[model samples]
Target: MAEAVARTSYGRLVARLARRWGDLSRAEDALSDAFERALRSWPGSGLPDQPEAWLLKTAHRRLIDGARQSGVQARAEPEIERLLDELTERDDPDALPDERLGLMLACAHPDLDPTLHTPLMLQAVLGLDAARIGAAFLISPAAMGQRLSRGKARLRERGARFDLPGKDELAARITPVLDAIYAAYGTGWDEIGASESRVRGLVGEALYLSRLLTELAPEIADVWGLYALIAHCEARTPARRDAEGRFIPLSEQDPQLWDAALISQAENALRRSLKLAPPARYALEASIQSVHAERRVTAETNWLAAAALYDAMIRHAPSLGALTARACAHGEAFGAERALDSLEKLQGQASEYQPYWAALAHWSARAGRREDAARAYDRAIVLSADPAVRVYLVKSRGALLR
Candidate 1:
């Protein structure tokens, strides 16, 4: 409920804070104080008649208090003070939504560490709870709490300005925001736990942020392309695994589980992305998903074509994730030998190299090499920290025991 209200009323909330206090810092101070008031008063009061109005009212009052304490107008920033003074003062009043656009720019600060920046945006601006945020990253809630605290302190020390970046710089900065969200989605999608809320939330938030970016720069194809990539991934999320929280390879997933509506939306997003000429990294990734999407069923999937798509991707981005995805395809199509040859070069590239060894285990089992399978499975079990990897261990060792 809090997240919904925050999302719905974000622009207005941001604006009123700026209007009352001028600039981002005091506005955030006023808003945070108002939030504290909400926490203290709302439970008993049963929510004011108009929550947005109540929040705006509380924010103004807090701004006034802050000004009194600071011995200056909270609206003291000269240019905006006049705008502030022109407003009528009253309890539970309504004002235009805040400039969430500007606030997004502020939140996407290049100077701030990218690691904490996305979570900070989720916490401060979107009002997501720590559990949800932590779940997004596949981390313990305690770890998330500590991380967010450290991030907030760093942001404070840097004293990031409440301003937008120039076009090129803004384009560069937006990538990290999207990257963090993508990282969250990746971990959460694989996580074998009941708490999948964070993954869903972060994926939703990432797409939202990308849309916001597109509005700010319609010419930025990468933004729309990113939207396509995430949307495509999200379209598959509900069916990515099954009821038991096990990893279900896409080949084995029921086609009916694929969300047709999301697929259609993703297709449109991909086309919208092409409007900017040569496609970017996300477009290529989406293109790969598109190949999978275009397939009528798993057997009909173009593994060779998919592998080629990944090869192009590697030439451009050269990440271990891309390399691993291709290796999985190789293992599925030709045999384990081909996959093993492909995975060997990626030893130092990934810390979680267990997936590669797991692939080897699968191939060893397929080749009926019991000893090789057991040894590879042992290495895989050691490398894997995630529970899902245990399934490979069981299958491989079971082959030997049989």
Candidate 2:
């Protein structure tokens, strides 16, 4: 129960506190202190009827105490007192306006280094520690920690506000926000049903943020596209694994188990996005997923259509992940030899990329290069972070040996 509440509420709680205090670091520290107090006190006192309220009051007091101790309260005492009074007047514990979306936008503020936007969002808005964000980005935790600290300092020095941008300024800031949300979703999607609850929480949080973005910026085509992409992927979650908890590749998933409502909602959003603008990366990606979703009704996967979408995606984004996915799609639509050629060109560039190894393993097996397939699978299993993915790779390699 504590774990679930922490997972669901921690980000929002921190974001609200940060907004009120105008100090992200202090907000985090106060909330951490409050949670620790709860852990120590809740066992004997029994759980409070309003845990979030209790947390907020405790964290607010901690912030007030800290400010007084630092002697900074002299100038800000009136504002601080007002905020405390506002908190006390709230009837519903969870009724705080979701400030996380605002915090996310602030983290992706254009004033900061562009490269740090997604990392900062992952840390500040999603509650991922620097170490976890570093692992995702293939950076050392120390480097990520320094980067986050520097980013926060820059925001503070510039007096960044935790408010959504105006319409005139929003477009310039949209890309980083979209990227951060996509990164969050990808992290969760990789670990679904893999016995990692924290990672799984990212799925819901990403979806929540995406939905909020769509509502906040209804006219933005990519917002709808991103939501559609996430929805399409999520629609297949019900059939992603079997009773034994083994991974089920998309092709082998039971279509009957797919959620019809989510698929309908995804298609609606995809259509709306396509109607609004020329293709963007998110729309293109959603189009590819839309094609995959069609397999349930058509009784056949459209490899050629998917390959075409991948080609478009690569031309637009040119990411290593996109290239690797395109190689697999090309293999499905063309032949193993052609896919192998594409994968070979990426050998040096994508050496550290897990999907590259996984793609190589699959294409190599299809091309009847058993030894090469085994070697690639070994590399892939070693690099994969998700235990389920590692197990699946191991099983694939065993099949080749047999």
lDDT, candidate 2, 214-234, per-residue tens = 876778888899999998888
Report lDDT per candidate. 0.65, 0.81
Runs in model 2 with CA error above 4 Å?
1-13, 33-61, 83-97, 110-123, 126-151, 187-201, 364-402
lDDT of 1 at 157: 66
For model 1, how does the per-residue alpha-carbon lDDT over 132-192 read when each residue is reduced to its tens digit?
8887777788998887766555545666554555767766666665565455455434322
With a 3 Å backbone cut-off (N, CA, C), the pairs that clash in candidate 1 are 11-97, 11-98, 12-97, 12-98, 15-98
Clashes of each: 5, 0
Model 2: per-residue Cα lDDT at residue 85: 81
Q: Residue 396 in candidate 2 has what lDDT?
A: 92
